[model samples]
Target: MDMRLEVVLLPVADVDRAKQFYAQRMGFRLDVDKPVKDDYRVVHLTPPGSGCSIAFGVGVTTAEPGSVQGLQLVVTDIERARDQLIEGGVDVSEIFHDATGLFHHAGEVDRVPGLAAGRASYGSFASFADPDGNGWLLQEITERLPGR
Candidate 1:
């Protein structure tokens, strides 16, 4: 038996706006956009090279918009990823790393300005948010940890 995370449900006040942000600004692949009923619709999107996708639309979730946070996307090059997002017209934060040389802290604790010492893998990060304020973090991982 295997459990894989294939999709994440996002809550947005305006479905079309969220769709445009994720599909056009974020450059995610639009996989599905179907109206299930008069008040229900489904929109699924996947990142460029990711198996997991995100879904949002009418009647998809009851959570408040901008409530989802700490969503992470891994990249091999943090600077390139941040540049790409900025080029796409997204407001991305400057690259930073944890002062403790481990994972980042919640909110903005232990956040140091610029990349980690020696540009270590899994240590560099940049952050951004969608139109609805759903936070996204870009982590640079030149090499994965054991069994990742």
Candidate 2:
């Protein structure tokens, strides 16, 4: 079986605003923006260097706006990624790492105030949200775990 995850449909109060935030602020590539029906619009976007894409627009999802969370993007250099987002007008959080050497705690718990020594894989993170409050996390993982 060749199952692969593709697009993530995000819900937003305003389609144009969310499109601007993702395309302008976060620098995601705007792949498609077209109206299919009188009440339906589809906007597709992809992050830089990413295989997966995200879609959101009118009539696309029934989920509440700003309700999605914990979406993650893996990066090789956490600090550089954070700085780029900050420069792009995003209010990114400070770099931090998990203390237990396993994984991070959710929502500001178990966070130490620095990147892990040697920039170990799966050790550091920074987070930010879209204008609609859909949360996204940047996790530094220079190497994948065995079999991953």
How many steric clashes between backbone atoms does each model show?
0, 0
Candidate 1 structure quality by residue, lDDT tens digits, 1-148: 9999999999998999999989899899999999989799999999999999999999889999999999999999889989989999999999999989998988778899999899999999899989999989999999888999
List RMSD in Å for every model shown.
0.8, 1.1
User: In candidate 2, residue 30 scores what lDDT?
Assistant: 99
Q: Report clash pairs, candidate 1.
A: none
Indicate the residue-level lDDT of 82 in model 1.
92
Q: What's the TM-score of every candidate structure?
A: 0.97, 0.95
Q: What's the lDDT for candidate 2?
A: 0.91
Superposed by TM-score, candidate 1 places the C-alpha of residue 109 at a distance from the truth, in angstroms, of 1.7
Off by over 4 Å in 1: none
Q: Write the per-residue lDDT of candidate 2 for residues 1-148, one digit (tens) a residue.
A: 9888889999899999999989998899999999999799999999999989999999999999999988998899999999999998999999988888667887888888888877889989998989888999999999999998
